[model samples]
Target: MILIRARVEAVLEPGRRTEVRVPVLLIASDRRWLELLPSQRARLKGRFGTPRSADLLAAVVVVRGPPSVLGPPSPLQRAAETVRARLRRSVDRLPADQRGVLPGMVVGDTSRIDPDLAEVFRTAGLTHLLVVSGANLAIVIGAVLGLCRFAGLGRRRAPPVAVLAVLAFVVVARPEPSVLRATVMGLIGLLALFTGRRRQGLPALAAAVLLLVLIDPTLARSYGFALSVLATGGLLVLAPPWRERLRRRLPGPLADALAVAAAAQVAVAPVLVMLSGEVGVVSVAANLLAAPAVAPATLLGALGAVTALVSLTLARLVVWPAGLAVAWVVWIARTAARLPYATIPWKGGGLGAVALLAAAVVAVLILRSRRLRLVAVAAMAGVLIAVVGLRLLAPGWPPPGWALVACDVGQGDALALAAGPGRAVVVDTGPDPRLVEGCLERLAIRDVPLLVLTHPHADHVDGVAGVRSHRAVHAVLTTPRGPGREARFTSGLVVRQALTGQRWSVGDLTLSVLGPLSAGPRLAPGDDGTTVNDASVVLVARRPGFSALLAGDVEADAQRALAGSVPAVQVIKVPHHGSRSQDPAFLAAAHASVALISVGRDNDYGHPAPSTVDRLRSLGSRVHRTDQEGDVAVVRTTGGLSVVPRR
Candidate 1:
């Protein structure tokens, strides 16, 4: 059995549907982990949004009920929490996305950060901007000193003041492991500067690393630590030279961004691949896009955090510029993350890291060669020309003749059934409209003849706008709207109930509703809280050479009923995100050639449960889960069936 002992951090914090993703802190004996979830989180009850300024001693544990606090948090801790809380409330009236990003830009109160928003940052390689780290600290403290210098403060006076500012900001940020690491690194650089050892950048970095490792040996094994130290070292040793070279041709602002992005990317790309198994194609470009917003957002957010203690209204007034800055960053992340080939999958682990490091070093060396630089520039320009030419002319995506595409929309379902050129039948928009919109855009789908919602779960139907955004949605099909779920994709388009035996055609593909039989089993009167997932509308699709059993969220009881009406198929969208609510006999009956499960990565609830995947595999179906493989597609050719993954 897998066991997780977590400490409650905050409660009823903003959620995605109503707002943003709330966070709870998991306090293990060894370390703390932030738990981001929709499951288990809802089970806790209380007036639980504790002000960040309070002594945060209370907790609701899932494994063991409320553990005793060893003692109250220290006064400094209380003060920091208060500032963070005030900062949070000051921006509470803003759009949830903007609000979620504000505290994060300042002190990293990411409890309000939506998982969908976080995922966008991850894909765009902008995770650092959202997380509390050295970069944020450096920007805030540096700006403070720069302001003082501009006001004619002497150099000696500015350094000491900046040092104090760093310490104070670190406390306000709560000195989590990553924050602590950043503080230590910043101090080392500052110490070097003060001692007139600025040329010893590498030595300063080495000393910081040695001292940190001695203090917390576990950090030696930390991916964050490796990334942090390497990134700082890159900035100190590599960025300045690149800046000088690029300044020869590029504007100062462009040159600085290019140098900073390249240095960090080269230094951390290997570790990033080691941890995430992919290198973002848009990392440099995304960083450039978001660069203009970071400093303003950070400074204004910090100002708002401090001012909220005095006047909430003033704090609100102060944060609007910060919120706008955050909005720009969010927009950059979303747009860059969805670009075709956002990341490049690479070999993971130590060997891959070492190989990539060597390659990065070689590229740096080539950049130093004047003659080779011209050739490299020409080669890069040629690649860009080819890419843009193809994008404008032949467009290489949605790979011709593809039959089915299962979008990687986190813990939800969004799929497309090809109809004709630029047309498809879309099913089940995921939780975030933006995510599903990108999926459709990637497929080049411009018209949706029929859009089917499996059920009324927020994860299933919430992304209606994505379906309606780019296309003329002729009609919509779904079960009778669940409580409070009457809103749909198009007011003009009809939402027909998906009763059993309902049949339709989109291009050559035939769709038949196979489940939610009329007059079927629902709950007894007193069991009103039971979910209606078992009542989800199941569909079966078939064409000349391809067939699929698309079971929505039906559980064992209804799975048995649906099995009786099933058609033999080559693929199946496993029901209920492959929860263990499956009936083995039902899976055996369908015997689909491929079983597809759509789920979010690192979800709280163990989805596409291991046993469920084993059950499908045991029944002779090759299993594919979206959480692991990403945007799975089934293509049928003359030979047999094949599976293609986005990344």
Candidate 2:
């Protein structure tokens, strides 16, 4: 599915026909929009509904049958569309991740980016690299101005050439709100720099903001708009002073880069803290590491886009250098994201923003003295070393001899069954890739002999990418009743159907597919949540002096069916997050010593029902809930078995 912005021409309201002028979001399955320009008119037959977020859009039109083309787009728009298509085709030879990022960095086209890779970029606070931000426009304008200077052109002549470059970039990148905002901010900064009149920059920025908000009032509420303005303000106001200070000790180029990155990060910290509830500890460093490559990648990608209009072969050659630069950026983001405590979780909302702002003010006051600045730097370094040291020395987490871990993925299931060093059998990746991936990272599991997806529900399998990211999986075993939509994440892997009585082993650990006795019964062609729940693939995992029942989400009916065959074990992953629809006979049959429940805190579904918890306790089981304990691990003890809670 693709989403496009469209204007509403008419409305049919019961007996009245009304003509209206309003902007709306259009959801369509048609590929025609790829060829159509930004403002082209089209006749669409669809049902209108209230938009989820009505901040920018009046309504959402979901295209039902087909879209009717009213007319062709303008000549310029057609050329731009052609250039975009050609550019995409030219980069076909690059690696999948690089190919996706190049277009995004150039023209804000991100349809091809891997979701897992996008998550990594987000975690590292490098998402700006994948968008048409002020940095991109700054690079383009800076390059153009440098060329004019290199040719010995006068400053007066350089502005006109730079203005042309800005216009062309806006057209090629499509005059979306973000692109327009970046263009305006970039031009203001250019004007300030070229004229050597830094004081006028603020008034120009204020006028630009007033004009833009008046033109499109919705931009006032947009986070992107706010960030663009703040970043530009920081560059004009804070960067110059900081750059001068840094140049006293550092080289000119390094000082400039550090000042820009630090100013932008400082300006946007409050907003980011409130929005994401986390502070990116490594963001400034990540941006600094990525800054050198941004200019080359953006310039080359744009050049490639233009060259594609003339010759696809030449465009491919031009894009190769851009690909290498993008690869470096990708590496930086991935590496930074993997670092310990890359982001520090904090309070969210207005309170968090206010608290962070206050802290920043205090920090700035303290760092004004040279001696204090040195002290602060040393303190921060010491803290970082301490964190790394503790992480390496900490023996409390992923406790030794741990055989099974129910990761706290929130309202979903993800379990790592240890096979050997850095190897495990991952089952039921949770609803998010980041949460599950973080759990695996903490456990230091990099190689997976088998990935068992109990069912095709999103909660059971949406995190498949996290399991495969920076790791190797020999095979994937899933239930036979897999739907095409949820199974797409496992596309490149060897996926096979898990059958009853099927057995597999890796190292000393062994697994047997127990239940999922039958396929989902035939029903109407809609989401049959119950039927899917019943078809969850149940497993019995065993090792020396340890065993577990990794019951996916099978409810009452399937639980009753498996009761006769399912044997008692040391631990059991309570079915369906311990919902009330459990079979007492099945619970009695297991008689597990420890029961693990994976559910989210304050979830709307009220999972791990009170009655279910009581029933498990009555069955002579000690319950360990992930929502309470963070990550519940069943480790082997010298005498018998014990539960470890990494809270």
Candidate 3:
């Protein structure tokens, strides 16, 4: 029954397009097991359905509890809801820094996790503490065992008590995928302990993984699932040998902690690098300091939270201890985050990650002997130093020379023009700060003489923070017009708008706004109590023989209005990410040598419509999209134009 329950819980349903009407069969069996069979897997589509289209035709079967309960808010749902509510309340009382750690520690609720903090945790190499995995369970079991021994509990009775404790912990944590995965791993660890077979850990971990994947084939695509499995496997396979080696040089306890941290990091680093495109050089050092605090903090926090729920007065007494633990974690995160270059950005994808992992494996194999280990370590350090040295001594940006870059910012538009040397003029700040920052970093853009915001849309203005953070802006230019169709600068960058419309020189480039003409109508603040796309600020930049126009999110009406008034442009940043709202006359009049589109991948709005691309192509304009080429750059040359892609 337990095995069947585990299989059923692990199963992922096939995808369904809609809530199709299908017959469901319920089979009742002894030992209180109920099986649900869907008549047609094709008819069961929804958020809970499988993620793959091919899987939709597969059988949809679920086995849980008894036949009496087979509907919405299944047993798992009911339990998760109760746990989530309690977690929400507990987190609400914690400081912002500590709030995110709770869900991760208790049940792996990453929904509220902060990206920056998560990065720090990863860099500091303490990410395992955030997940309720085998390590967490081991800590709990070990503590319980120690307590039992102190209380004079019999060894035989202790196992039963530990099992019961495990069950209670699972219930409180809720049966999420991570919790279930951890529980299975924990149970196996306990079984190994009881049988006095330490070597059983690897086999148990592998078996658990196979069982999980077999039950839910969809987990193959889940990064979290892969990371959890790999981290656990790494610990099981590498920690022992690593610990043994470390014990020879350091105190037993310190060596054990360092080995555990190193093993998990070695196992998960490839995946983390692939997903994040950055490596934490300081992760090992950070985790060394943080390791001792995680267990006590989590245990105390959990106990205090549970006690507070039961008795407010008693909860207050425990809060101090809990607070101290939380403070330690908070301190670790802040300190790690403050370190310069804590995370070194790297190029990532499947190939890079695989190569890195292969390298790690080779390095590990080479470490078997003391002499080779020292040599391997020295070689690795040398390689790192060489890479850093080359990067620092490199003549100019990887792909040197001037270029105009169109940043991928989803539905908004942002283009950067490098006049010559390190001088540049920026037009539009993309909708997301992080995305824009990534684009700038790729281009090695440092200083901006003019920061032109095409008009304020959250998409265009949100990336202003990124600009302010990375580059020195002498002046900003915007169409005298305020936010066109939506609330402007809500993401905390609006305060920097004071320099709008002020012209600034950056070495040799000049930037200025062309429209949002003071005489134009107040852009018909739409029925939604805001202006529409027609009011976007349009920018025109000129430098020697090079010229470009940055059309914000302006629609056809504004495009037509501007076409009759503005001067010819050599390059055009297609308005509204090549939305169909563009005026044909405007495209023809601009006669741009190049057209740039800033759009995100798989965006729902279907930007850069076929017709718009065709129109620009028909006019002898070369069109480039950020989605395909990453940051697109156009540099002015005495003879003509030079193009570069961040990719």
Candidate 4:
């Protein structure tokens, strides 16, 4: 039986806390068992303890449940907690530079790493530096082997010593599932070396993968697991052949470095492309610069970690070496990130990844031969270059015409109007910042002449981050203030009331705010109730022969209150994302030719109800749902109206 201990760190539910365990995992790597006892489960009803450092040392063991479960208190939980505490203490004693790299190098704990520093690493394409993986284990083993050889231990003894070192390192790092997997793979590789059976590396890797997947089928869904496995497999299968080929063509050191970088990149590229939809062109260059530093940083960081266990003074001295290595890595990242077009975005997922990988394999195979390899690689490279060039040079917006776009933002509202060249206006920001940013990029919108925030709901305001990215904001109009108005305003947006008689120009299109008719009394459903939806800013946009009405989430009451104040419109954004509480009279007054509804599929609220849709259809208005049609666009010309739905 594996014994574990941990302290409650965060209260996830009323009586359940997310705990960090000590001594990490004491069980077999593939062990499966229940974690909590019946008596302990019964006593979990009341608040157990405060989630503070002082209370963290009071650890508890979980005697029942699957070992793969994250954050729940268990035998493994105590071990994780203990490692975290020790690492924290180590970091606190180190210099700033070494402190930044310590946890990541030792245990893949990057939660304490600053976001700015993380971004720097990302830009440099050295993100693997923050993760504890086979690469890290390899570096450790390589260093150990080098040390043993220097001390006069022959090559045969090197493998055993390396394996022993890996086992000890795993204990210090805490035997999390990921750490265990890495250790197992490292040990297998070292054993292969000792036995002169290096060809068994692939089978060993496959076995480790199968074992881990069987123990926790859910790990199959983990991106980290996929990345780790692919990277290791790449090193085994591709690295050796690449190294030999490069060695024949170039100097020994350069060939070896290039081979390592190329093999890992080729293996992991498809997975990275599939997940991020972007390829880092500078990854090879970044790795070549950062790879040499990894061993020193890891060894010194580990030394600092051990030294911290005994004397703070000793740990501080060790930190200097680690910090210097980390600084070099940071420099590499910053330089790589700043290179023009370092990352190229592409459409991603299984098909795209497979296609790229197939092309890469064909190119590599062709290159292996003396005759046809060069031609094949050149042809493939040309095809990729042409495709990328065409996409970059393609004209994004409709040619010299006015258009209104209702961006598909899941269950929130965001609309854009392209009036003329390089000019547009944005209506309500959506619920997701990333989605909204993507929409802006697709539309090729750079400047906002005016930004209209209809109301203060999270759906309408969450994309404020995206909006703020624009260089300039000429004006921002919002609904009249009430209880939560101040809190809802986007950080830098200048908020104003949509009073009667306010006019704004967005390129060739002119806009006017029509109603609320009067400032209604602050809504109060009950003593405990706060309703922000009752107040919405309504506006009308008109250009030459086209017109549209943007009605924020104003319900039936607000609509009735405005009555005849609203004008007829060619297009109408259905209020509250087609919620059932829409006012029929408001729809009748608008007399819209097309009604746009923004909502999500299978949303709990059952939005765009049949009744509301039928009402718009009865009024002879073509109904379009963003959820169904994706991004919906309407182009208005003197001839008539044309609609575009994303394919």
- Give the winner by TM-score: 2
Clashing residue pairs in candidate 1 are: 15-20, 52-81, 52-82, 53-81, 53-82
Error of 3 at 270 (Å): 3.0
The residue-level lDDT of candidate 4 at 253 comes to: 92
Q: Please give the TM-score that candidate 3 achieves against the real structure.
A: 0.59
All candidates: TM-score: 0.64, 0.66, 0.59, 0.56
lDDT of each: 0.76, 0.83, 0.64, 0.70
> Using lDDT as the measure, which candidate wins?
2
Q: What is candidate 3's CA lDDT for residue 206?
A: 74
Q: TM-score of the candidate numbered 2?
A: 0.66
Model 2, residue 190: C-alpha shift (Å): 7.8
Ranking by TM-score: 2, 1, 3, 4
* Per-residue accuracy of model 1 over 1-647 as CA lDDT, tens digit each: 01243344343446632333333333221112222211223233222322221122232232222333334556676777778888889999999999998888788778788766887899998998877888788787688778888989876667677788889998787656667777776777766566666546667668778888898665776677788888888888889999998999999999999999888877789888875668788988999889988989998899888899999999999999899999999999999988977987776668878878787787878878999888989998999899788768852455557889999898889989888889989889987787898889888899998898877666788888877885788888886423224254446777677777878998798999887877765533222211467767789988878888888788888887777677678899999888878987778777798999998765545576779988888888998877757788787778878887876
Candidate 3's residue-wise lDDT over 1-647, tens digit each?
11121112222345633334332222112234323322111121111222122221232233222444345445655554555555556556667666667657755555566645665575566776776766567767777888888999876667667877788777666554555667777777667666666647677777777777787665665577778888778788899998998999999999998998788878888888776666677787777787787787667656655665666556545544555676687678779876756776665667768878787778768866798888878987998899789758754433555556777665567777875555566777776677677667767778866677766555677677777675777666555555442234333323233232544455566655555555665443321112335556676667776777777777787777778766677888888778777889988988887888887643434577879999999999998877656567676667877666544
- What lDDT, from 0 to 1, does candidate 3 have? 0.64
lDDT of residue 171 for candidate 2: 82
Candidate 4 C-alpha RMSD relative to the actual structure: 11.6
Pairwise lDDT winner, candidates 2 and 3: 2
> lDDT of candidate 4?
0.70
